[model samples]
Target: MQKQADRVVQILKSKGLRVTPQRFAVYANLLERLDHPTADQILNDLNQDAPTSSQATVYLSLQTLRDAGLVREVLLEQGVCRYDANVEPHHHFRCRCCGKIEDIEWDAFEGLSFRKLRAGLKVDSYEITVNGVCDRCQH
Candidate 1:
């Protein structure tokens, strides 16, 4: 079967965005590794093959991808920013011991009535992050 993730990249390109090698590498990295990587982590991972991706390049590429809604950013303890490739209204979990991030299945908003409470408030995004030890670190 064809992959749905590849369609995401195609949609991004059709919007007139330049698909650079570095950007493609970033997307591939995200696809391979589901862990939420900080910009530095992404740089380190990319450096394994692309030994010259400067920190600034990663930041710019992340911004471009995020702006296109292809990626989403999450903040954890101490204002640390982590990135996730799945952007379809999901929750996140962060490990306190190793700072690893994982996606958690949650649908707690099904009964919420935020619009009724605010009377005119427009809610666009939702983020939920829980911090604790991951299974690997506990071993």
Candidate 2:
């Protein structure tokens, strides 16, 4: 836990952000859960042990963390955003039946890049979401 805390502090300092208690709580939650939770989901889970923590606090913390590049948000669908603690490049596989998000690590694809036919086009990152029943859901 101390190592994770140190990492959080380092990230905040490197990004010129303050490492506040609320921010740490939010970040620690994301790191521990690894579930790619929505804002509401994060609030609910945090409330279990932190009843005084407000929904707005969670939102603000999430936004700050995202802005600092310590966390990443993936828009899986319309009006739905999921928070990911893993900032490293990777793909996500969503289970259509259960709405479960799974990370697919393919380092080979991380360096993949392509040129656009049109001018002034650039691709910062790549994404490939396989929408289908995952193995567990199929069984």
* Top-scoring candidate (lDDT): 2
lDDT of 2: 0.85
How accurate locally, in lDDT, is each candidate?
A: 0.78, 0.85
The true-versus-predicted C-alpha distance at residue 59 of model 2, in Å, is 0.8
TM-score of each: 0.77, 0.86
- TM-score, candidate 1, is 0.77
Which stretches of model 1 miss by more than 4 angstroms?
1-9, 108-122, 136-139
RMSD of each: 3.2, 2.4
**Residue lDDT tens for model 1, 1-139:** 1364466568678877877777766766776778888889999999986498999989988888888777888776677787778888878888889877788776844675565656777787667777899999999
Top candidate when judged by TM-score against the true structure: 2
**How high a TM-score does candidate 2 get?**
0.86
Candidate 2 contains a number of clashing pairs equal to 0
For candidate 1, the per-residue lDDT at 94 reads 84
